[model samples]
Target: MISALTAPAPRAGNRAPRPIYVTKGGDMLNPFTPTPTDPPSYLAKYTARDTAPGLARRDAVRTLLSWGLEQLADAAELVVSELVTNVLSHTSTRTINVTLIRTGETTARIVVMDTDRTEIVLPACPGDDEEAGRGLRLVASMAVQWGVERVVTGKLIWCDLQEDR
Candidate 1:
């Protein structure tokens, strides 16, 4: 497991410092902020094929189960499936990397990274009659926090899930 390097002082916004995870070599795992890197709690790379989403979902569920977070399995599975499916549908990238991190005793994070740099756009308000375009909204409803961040190679979309939900 990677150790956290707490920031010595509060950030400019006065928010309490967040735990920063880094490599022993002093390289930041994520450029924008600290996140799990190098050896994530769970990591899997999948080709952008039809079976990719299912496989990713399976891996996420398995990882959560192993961590004794069975309550999050259903939400995590759907979140993983939708994120991976979005990557496959919108990008031509050959592979997608899925990472799951146990943030707390009953909270975990799910991240999907792909080569596509296009920013994700969500509908202002998807109509009930629409057959699609509700995946991200569903994710937003289920997750305590969700967002996308740009990396040097690609963009990673992430969401935080809590067992209470």
Candidate 2:
């Protein structure tokens, strides 16, 4: 089932409100279109390459810091890196779209979309000492909530993190 929380009431002179769907676990299911007056957000597309993850991490950090969300920088950086890396490693997609949205007063959502239709395998515990694996596992642990959804073009994987206050 899908549930949604309406975007917070718009600021004066802002456009009509939009709804953001969320899973029961609090992971965002839909990427809301931002009105001009909405809170800070970052969206960009990157070529699917070995360096994309690092580049995405840099963008994620810069965006968060710009919004005074530096407290989330560490987690956000790791999450963005892992998600982007997963795409380049697992899928044949040539590009990816990364979006960082301010979902609430202290909550932010990171979404990575790739143009591949492969089913996402839920992360399994990697045996210790393995030199690989564990990217998604790290994301699952850090994110307050997260999940993947199939989209017409490919798949959207999102995770939510809230500043500890």
Candidate 1 lDDT over 1-165, as tens digits, reads 356788889758896777865443222222222244433377767767998888788778878887789999999999999999999887878789888988888999999999876766554676889788888899999999999888988888999999987
User: Per-residue lDDT of 10-99 in model 2, one digit per residue for the tens?
Assistant: 999997687664434212222223323476676767778887887788878887877778889999999999899989888999888999
After superposition of all CA atoms, the RMSD between model 1 and the true structure is: 9.3
TM-score of 2: 0.75
Tell me each candidate's TM-score. Answer: 0.73, 0.75
lDDT of each: 0.81, 0.81
What lDDT does model 2 reach? 0.81
lDDT at position 94, candidate 1: 79
